[model samples]
Target chain A: MSENTTYREAVKRAIHKAMKEDERVFLMGEDVGRYGGSYAVSMGFLEEFGSERIIDTPLCESGFTGAGIGAAVNGMRPIVEIMTINFSFLALDQIINSASKLLYMSGGQFNVPIVIRMATGGGNQLGAQHSHSLEGWYAHVPGLKVLTPATVQDAYDMVGLALDHPDPILIFENSNLYNTKGELDTNATPLPIGKAKIHREGKDLTLLTYGVNLLKALKAHERLAKEGIDVEVIDLRSLRPLDDEAIMASVKKTHRVMIVDEGWKSGSISAEIMARINEQAFYELDAPMVRVCSAEVPFPYAEHLERAAMPQVDEIVAMAHKVMEES
Target chain B: MSEFIMPSLGADMESAVLMEWKIKEGDKVKKGDIIAEVETSKGVIEIEIFEDGIVEKLLVEPETECKVGTPLAIIHSVSERINISPAAKKRAKELGVDLEKLASQTKGTINLSQVEATDEKTETKAPTTDGMRQAIARAMSKSNTEIPHYYLSTSINMTAALKWLEELNSQRPIGERILPAALLIHAIVLALKKVPQLNGFWQNDTQEIISEINPGIAIALRKGGLITPAILNTQEMNLNETMHSLDDLITRTRTGKLKGGEMTQQTITITNLGDLGIESVFGVIYPPQVAIVGIGNIMDVPWAENDMLCARKVVKVTLAGDHRATDGRIGAQFLDKLDKILQKPEELL
Candidate 1:
């Protein structure tokens, strides 16, 4: 219980715990069983559950994803691992067209208890193909629950919550954060999907973000704190069915908002958040909403190019300072 | 004959550039006519004639910077004879005594020495970099110094109002969709129509309120700063028309392309914070206007009805008024009427 573990280990332990506690739960995806998952988040699970339970699927994302959906509909809890969000596009037919729609399109006949885990966001120079933060894209799709666990506690608990959800769930883990380690309270209960956590409370401005950007926002928050700017960092762990109540509550106290997202600028989650703030908290705003998003370009192979393409700590800090000055 | 003293033009400035003249010596003038354009730190502002008469003498020429309170021109009435003061005549002579030549060359009193002095000062002083910032500072300073403000806050249930908006939006195109801000603006305009007393200027000297419903909607610009652009004659406009006007004003404001009449002549203001999630905010009453309405965020809260608690969408509205012009009773009555109008949003339409 007191052993040092990586973020990847924390997630694997949570999955193992949930699967062991419930016999209905099983794992399925390419390399998830025999290969112990592409990121090793399911290492040693195949021996414990066997090939039937720990399903090693073909490279067909749509096919295997469809299988996961079918299994979930038939009263089996299925966790589908997509190697990376970059590969999820192949499975969009099953995820978006099938999994996301089953609950609503069926008029509530079928509840798709499917958890689709994907490593998202560009950081390790995975080139344009492998690296992408597609959480916003998934969040935009209705009937799909999107969860991004930035901390160990969240990573340990979100899997349980996603399993409990009677709908399709997309959980994004940053490839760069796999080695990040933090303490986890084993007895911690599962968190509600739509609730945002204020990791650091400050009065100057509210930094609203989720996923990998949450870490970037926290870094920016630390830098700003040194400069005497009290930035309130809100980690929107769940993207869809957004916790506007939590966001607005913080906004009411802070009076300024700066959204941080790793997605491209236009039509991103930041735009939606800004619009909601404008529609809901217009009077409380002393300044207009600011967003720090990834550069609207394809990810490049060069380390410097990729770093520039993604939203950085400096950019977030600058945005926070700008909002602070406005307030 | 009466001499027109140079207007202060603005605070902080002791002198203003006499940029141009609309009239010359011997020209007949009427009160309220644009007599000249004076350049200050703010902008080139038109100076209006105060009295109806014939221009017998002009004391300040184009390009001349004259001190405030210095005589700029002499307007002679039909019953009064023009008398040139000996001191002014001597001063004019010492500065090169060619009255006819000066009038012919400049069409006004050519204060050459004053112009030379101002030119020397301009070269020595650093030019102001931010004109809008300077104007805002001056305006804010003046308002804070001159106005006596009092704030009153009330919570309004927007449950019925939002539902009405949803119903209205369902029937409209995406472009014509009714938003909460639009509905609030409409409600505020209608409320002003009912409480016309709040929509006016307070003449502090006489302690009288002059009513006009020119509603200023505070627009937050994308680049920086807040500006309250006025929507003239709010009382006469329908909900759709007001919404359309507000949309146009905000579009212009965000683009930094506001027309001349958009910022000035506001009789009252509405600062909406509903989008930013603030429950209620107390706003400082902009000077001249007796009151300003601050709209807060809409949220679900428990409300008591028949001794039972029920969830309802409530918005906090604060009305900041000049106590000299309005009493608490009048403010309370206005808010009550505003709440009623907002609750029954269909009445505004």
Candidate 2:
């Protein structure tokens, strides 16, 4: 079935399919059952999958998320959904202390096959607490596999892939992408989580990034190509075990890099990428590495300020020009 | 299925000696599995396959020399059939022709150009060999015979450098001791910036200046001959970083655990004969790369300063460059910069 759906809908379909395929698979989150999910991702999931599989919890993110992990440790595949990334901070103790470290701390005996999904990024003028991108923070933890499903296709397939992996995986979904529609081939296969995908191929500069920033980078790449500045855009679908091989290979050919992330610049995922490039392919670069990141400030309340606070296509293009220049 | 050809380890290496086989005929092998060990002019290298297959036949015996691009076994792979010409493969790719489409029309070898010409088919054969040493032999011979090489040597005052190294190492633990070669490498990297023309490759009748200064460091193996694997991006590294990297590189090179890029990514070379007690050496430029910087053992030499002759520790530096890419003037500038760098070896740290 050739289908076109929003990113959030694709996510719902994946959860439904996973639950149908396996008896032990279940989803638990705030408003996921009777309330049909905060974002309406699981609108009818409660009726079809029933309360046993589609669980609705109170406002305690820590309590429900911990229950999901405990269930996962006991051989049940639990998909924990956080209403928003801001609330994931409330359960940071459970996610960091137990979910991520269980396998290593337990001598590889307890492989936490838990998938945590959360709405991330800023666009809806939600207050600072609700409108922040914190996927970069999760990527720092060693035992967790962090993912960003930018496209509808990725949103559709990555959930299943993450569920199949014998490790804890945190998928950060951009709140802005929930309404973005794209074609999803019904027969599409799951891509390996650790590998990156090249959205565009060029030879002059490589735009390394993930999540919804991929679209802005692609647009910038196309604009750059018009001026004969071929820009290669790589979507780093995997965050924790960053695909350095793909990043380095692109940098080797391009001789320049521009990392665009929704996170803050200092100590951000972009910083990690620049450090990796410095360690692996510092000599391959002809110019200094550049980062197009969200401004290091609390999410602004005003729309204009919000637009100015985040990474845009023009900023990426300008940064590309700056780094790709001959000194 | 998949033909495990002799890998081109280095730009200069064309073949290797099939010293031993870890897996014989009928043994199943997986990707990244060490199937054989081959000794090149550099050293014995453990060869790993990139595909899973069953060893159908052992094409060449152990200890036999072979050439570059020579295959070593007829492995019945879980993958598709081999022997598809690259040109035909490209054509097939352009037309979206896959293995399934060709399997019905052809048998054995599949060549797009010859498909309609005849029903003639080519047999699958793996031409295995001990070609690494031979490859190096052929490359170096070609470089010596065809390329116009110009050599330049200079005596550098290493008094301050040696003194600096001794003082720096005295404060650190013995395991963290820095070698003199690190200083030399640092100085050469800085010199390369000033004299950039000689620090790259001469390819396809053109001269290209490489941005990063990855120095191919010659490491002597236990058996004989030597392999010059690259220590990448030396320009950005500090003297301390250089020292640590050199330690790791030398250790890995001797252990035959060299990364693939290390073997093939030399933009220029650094040959230090100081450890072997050589006073000076006029070394060869590793092919593809255009230049090499050589350092000799430091010795006490008489120096004249302020009209007084005093004994100073001095080391000889030699530059071997491809004359086609650069002239003696460029080589002289590099040596001059090197000498100046050595005077302030403290800055390298």
Candidate 3:
């Protein structure tokens, strides 16, 4: 029952556990039935559920994603996998326009209880087209809960929470964090979305970020700690309906903020976060808002180029220190 | 006759191009009349005539760039005027002090150092560690030396005020910033209008009181230390004008570019430590000003109204005045008027 698990393995275990608890739960995706999965996160699910449940389909993301929405509306909980978020663009019409809007647009007549999981973020040398962190983009759309689980406990707990919700949910898993191991307990329950968790408590500045950037913020926190700067790392697991009160409370204490996001600088989630802080806690601010986001360029093919395109730990630390020294 | 030195309009200004002259060489002009237009860091501002007299000579012409503190013109009074020595005029010109206005106001020969001291006080210096520490030293020394300041603390319910601000701000643009500071300024102006004695200065030399409501607002700069820039005739100005004036003062103060006229002649002062979460503070009265008001942070506290306890957002306003000119009853009445005005902000509009 107990075993050493990576974030990816923890997610796979949560999916299998949910499937065993309810016969109505099923898995469907391209190559998920026979090829296990692109990352092997759903390796043995095909043998367990068979063809009737472990459904496979052609390379039509919009079709399968729409099918998943339809099945969820009919009282069957469906787990849909779109190999990577880059391919989710082809199915964006189904996920954003259809699945995300069905509940609100129908005035509560219909509910889309589907969990769409996708591989996100860069670090696997997965070239320009294959690697990108689109969590901020998905988070921009309303009526869909977006979750980014960076730890093993969150990976285990988020699946049950998504299944229990009466609306469509999107979960982003970082490709480079697949083998990162952490502790998890069986007694862990579903966590409510729209609430931020303070993973590390420090007094200097609050680092607001989510998804793969959460790990980068944590790394920056460690480096700042060595310089005698205690940084408060806030894992904003949920993006929309943000926990603004929590963010403001932390900002009032620290008097400074640095937002991190793996998205373009303009009109990104980091911008929205900083705007909220400015509106609510401007008098408390000692310095203006600082943002560390992905460079405003298309991801390149080379390894060094890709790393430069994404937000790094050094940038976050430098921005935090700069703000601290200003006031 | 006294020499009129060119006013240093703004910080970082070494010289100015005399744009246009509103008065001719022999034109008789009164104080506060626009004599010329000069451009500064902010915008084109009309240079005012600081004394009443006939313009004797025009030292600088239009299109001519003159250094600050140089004599721009000369004026002669028809009636008996205070005698000003040529050495004093030279010294005043060097210090950028308007000798004619100083002689007219003092009704005696004016010391150049007093003008220099006044100018020194007006110039914005980046607050160094020693300056702030010295200010603290002077403040504590004065508190212990001069007037005995008795502290009286009480909180007023601000639930109504907070709701009013929210409703007013919803209809305003982002530029017309409405903050607690604006509300406090409005309330204090109304109170001082009712009790003009609180706005008077404690003149030690003649043992006389001069009443004027030149309300000064304390601005804490980004770097350190503090500066009080006064808004003349606060009671006469409307709320919009008050807000505009305050915005102009704060913007200039933060950028370290406050003009000479912006700093001189304050009759009363208001310092807000509310932003820093100070519950209440007793500010030392800046000499000549009889009263100084301190505003505290707004917080929710349980209050008993109609024999029932309910949470209300409340702020404490403390008034420290010169007992030589004002008593406890006058101070209490002023506070009551301020509280009433804050509760009914529409009257100020």
Could you give the TM-score of chain B for each candidate, in order? 0.61, 0.63, 0.60
TM-score of each: 0.52, 0.49, 0.52
lDDT at position A214, candidate 3: 81
TM-score of 3: 0.52
User: Which prediction has the highest lDDT against the true structure?
Assistant: 2
Query: Which of candidates 1 and 2 reaches a greater TM-score?
Result: 1
- Candidate 3 per-residue lDDT, tens place, A1-327, comes to 345678888888889999999888898888888899887888988898788788887899999999999999999999998889999999999988999898888999999999999888876677877878777788789888888887888888888888988899998888777788888775755567778899899887888988778888989999999999989999888887688988998987776788998878887788888888878876556556688887887787788888888889878888888876654
Considering lDDT, where higher is better, how would the candidates rank from best to worst?
2, 1, 3
Off by over 4 Å in 1: A1-4, B1-349
Q: Against the correct fold, how does model 2 do in TM-score?
A: 0.49
* Residues A92-129, model 2: lDDT tens digits: 99999999999989998998999999999997888677
Candidate 2 vs candidate 3: which has greater TM-score? 3
Runs in model 2 deviating more than 4 A are B1-349
Residue-level lDDT tens digits of model 2 in B1-349: 6577888889999888888999988788899999999999999899898888778788889999978778888777756554554334544555555644455334455544443222122111111112446667888898898678999999999999999999999999999888888878878888898888988999887999999889999887655557888889887898888888888999987666789999899999888888888998898777778888888998888998799999999999999999999999999999999999999977877
Residues forming the 10-long window of minimal summed lDDT in candidate 1 chain B: B120-129
Predictions' DockQ, in order: 0.00, 0.01, 0.01
State the local distance difference test value for candidate 1: 0.81
Docking class of 2: incorrect
What TM-score did chain B of candidate 1 earn? 0.61
